[model samples]
Target: MTRTSAVSLIRSRTLSDVAEYAYAATAPAGSRLIFLAGACPLDEHGGTVAVGDYAGQAARAVANLRTALADAGASVEDVISTRVLVASARQEDLVAAWQVVRDAFGDHDVPSTLMGVTVLGYADQLVEIEAVAAVLDEPQPEGAACPPSA
Candidate 1:
């Protein structure tokens, strides 16, 4: 496996799992790449976030994505593309859910695709997010600055 660093917004202050803090910055060259599968509003124990709440579902979806990225040695900043899924008939619900998704992905204006679906793998899951990211082997160029975190 390739050596990977954790990309985060806030550095851990204690010994317990510390999240790194990173701002908006370009990635290094020849970075390792990883694509994350679509993540739904499922908990670590295979539980649903919100049964019918779009916002809650969206939040969980993004959280799940984060976990997946961490497991794969990647971060939201590494993600370059995303596909968003929503299962709702009301446009308002979808818009609300999208906002949640936007907020979760650091709101860095990353590339994303939003789609309306009739249903998801789980009946209670109303939101799903999938993405592709590149993890750099080194820091940004000598003169480059890291991007601000969301």
Candidate 2:
């Protein structure tokens, strides 16, 4: 069976380093796209895991994002884009959170936006992230029956 992988698109004028976040993404046909809600620092017990610490909160949020993708039969490699939000607009805080995000994404080079905000949904929550992934469907053998969609 054959499957198509996601493609990252870049414009000629853009910096090559921006491959870390392609200006656009193209998913293969018949791919199953998953849109995840923003993930916070909530622990297994549904309580906030890291309070006041941006880096710690970022790590927990990234972990939660992985869990969410796994639940949808996806993985970090399938991610196409991500939006990262930090409670403070400070560069240091954004850097702290971005480091954790980079660690989580590894070499995948998924497109991402890192921004600072005045507040978040949960009180004391320093970081949150939302992601979109494309899980490609394997090509069925010729004449095989098609699988039903969920």
RMSD in Å for all candidates: 11.8, 3.2
Candidate that would win on lDDT: 2
Q: Lowest summed lDDT over 10 consecutive residues: which window, candidate 2?
A: 2-11
TM-score of each: 0.69, 0.82
Predicted structure 2: lDDT:
0.83
Local accuracy of candidate 2 as per-residue lDDT tens digits, 1-150: 433455454444555754455666668777889999999999888788778888999999989999998787678888888999998979999989998998888877677899999999876788999999998766689999987544
lDDT of 2 at 81: 88
Model 1 Cα shift for residue 30 (angstroms): 2.8
The deviation in Å at residue 125 for candidate 2 is 0.4
Across 18-111, the per-residue lDDT of candidate 1 in tens digits comes to 2122222334556666777888888778888778898988888888888888887677766766778899778888888888877776545565
Q: Which stretches of candidate 2 lie over 4 Å from their true place?
A: 1-13, 16-19, 139-150
Cα-lDDT of candidate 1: 0.71
